[model samples]
Target: MVSQVVWAQVRSKAGRLVERPVRELRGERLEEYEAVWQPPRYQGRRAIATWWRPADRARHVGCAHLGALGAAVSLEADRDVVAFASWPMRLHWADDAGGYVPDFFVRLADGRVRLLVCRPAGGSPQRWEAAAELLEAAGKQADWQVHVHEGTADPVVFSNLQRLSRWRHTRLADADTARVLRKVFAEPQPLAVGVRESGLPELPTVAKAHHLIWTRKLLIDWSSPYMPHRSLVWAPEGVV
Candidate 1:
């Protein structure tokens, strides 16, 4: 079956609209899009405009709703994501059916680009499925990845991510304390035990430990409920 052609429109940094065929977008051009794109303001019931500062990037990202904000938090927690922007572009069908503004554009550490759509769980799955089809087709043509993220399936994990994000800022990191943590958690141990064994002052060491976990220098069972004293923590393989 022949795939439908897709085109993208984005606002440039100077506030000019620029349109291009999806097939033509790749490499350095993606960065240009990120630099220029701005998220649209949302209005009406449950609509909100908010900003998030990701640990991996120095700038604040705008989110259009709670779901988009959650998606941004998930992106921030992902170790593989190098950078991301919300509402980066609008995808239009060449046939002029309509257009969609995807919720996020992500640049991964392995040099892959992804387009993301955010929807609350229990929303119209059929509608989002159709949107995913169009976006995925565009992604294929552009050599990009695509996803439609429903609301958090695991509240435990999402809660844990939120907790860790509080410590995600680089300002919380202590190199000396991190080194001690890496060795102390070289073997799997409870969170409080590892922090205490670091031999630093309790308060600061605990914060640094959480920061390391946020940065993925320390690994935890994200699937499990987080506990300050009981949750297990360990360094990734070969870290010690």
Candidate 2:
């Protein structure tokens, strides 16, 4: 009862200070079903399909990358693990599933699950911190291991590294740190192969150069291999 009262007070105070609906800019809508990249690179329906869709080749490839990383590090470690991306968490309302979700979900061979929250570096720090706290609180009641990864130097490996940073090497049971090292430091081959096989390399000059991949309903155009662009917003109605 005391804890609930304290939480209510905290929530009331937070509501007074935090911004309600945070918005990020994508690109101008060219038509009802299309969005032209203001600069032509990672803004259209294709780009969204490529990076955001769970079934997209790139997204699956990322999962493989995480798994491979875990497997590789297991060779010299004492842990058994499996890793994947976009493992959505069911949000609960008063006791049922709520719409809020967490990003990555990792499971150990023994069945323990960990919820990972990853935020790209260039995002609003305040919101990122708030999100981390929210996930942590949710984990406390849900019995899942919770973690947050912050984007730093490269967006490509942002979440991988941020979550890896939590371990206190001194407290790690083994020097290998299987989970940490595997996730944040995996090889780039899997991603490259999947991207090429997706016909990303055979597309037209503009599409290829912009990293656009065609999907049944949309196009994911304009992605960068370098810095992270955690800044993304949903498309408007009638605009892809």
Candidate 3:
């Protein structure tokens, strides 16, 4: 509660320096984008994607880039981000040469704007810290909360999450099959064993499990590789 009051005070201080949304730009930056590059590119891949969130996700783009690291970052965005954009936001200061456009503009669960830059371990460039300082100052002036994401999660965990994310949209068509799988998962055990002992058709049973994991009705160790023969999962409310 104290933190909420503090944030409110900060927002009050910001006092509408800029009226536009964070993702939109006016004047010089818009002109350069419209008349010059047309679209931003990272490793020949223009930043674009439909977000995973259900509320008007189709109309909102979530990220942009074309590389392995970019792909990993995009996955993290879909799984963990509340909302985001790729190179669509910029911040300019009066004395600076020009505006600064970071790699990503992320809105986290806490209502803080994160200027995310994905870089290799031990390879951070000096410009990032400079931009971070500038953006922080801008936020402070406006009484908005801003954060800089300079580090990444564990690679193994990232890869594991990526693999499981493939099943995020999976669903089961057969009601009976889904029921059986739910019963099987009600008691935590290896999925392969559940399929075998339940005497349900292996193919269909496994498909329903994918849906469960996707919906988070079934929880697994997202930080480790999914062991098809041995990952443990169960229903919510400490059922496992």
lDDT of 3 by residue, 1-240 (tens): 111111110011233223233222211122112111123445755445333322223333333333324443443435465655544445555444355655444565655555555432343577666656666655554344454444335777566655555555434545566666677778778878888877987886787777667656666777767787888876566433
The candidate with the higher TM-score, 2 or 3, is 3
- Give candidate 3's whole-model lDDT: 0.51
lDDT of 1 by residue, 35-68 (tens): 3445454465467768888774666777777788
TM-score list, all predictions: 0.81, 0.32, 0.59
- The C-alpha stretches of model 2 lying farther than 4 A from their native spots are 1-79, 83-85, 90-100, 150-240
Task: In angstroms, give how far residue 70 of model 3 lies from its true place.
Answer: 5.7
For residues 1-240, write the lDDT of model 2, one tens digit per residue: 111100110112223311111011012110111111111244442322122222112333112223333322221122343434442323323322122344445555666656555454355787566556555555555455775543234444334332222221223232222222223223222323333433423323212212211110112212333221232212123332
Estimate candidate 2's alpha-carbon lDDT, on a 0 to 1 scale.
0.31
Clash counts for the predictions, in order:
0, 13, 2
| lDDT ranking from best candidate downward | 1, 3, 2
Provide the overall lDDT of each model, using Cα atoms, as 2-decimal numbers.
0.79, 0.31, 0.51
- Sort by TM-score, best first: 1, 3, 2
Which segments of model 3 are wrong by more than 4 Å?
A: 1-56, 59-80, 109-112, 119-126, 142-145, 170-179, 196-205, 237-240
Question: Comparing 1 and 2 by lDDT, which wins?
Answer: 1
**Most accurate candidate by lDDT:** 1
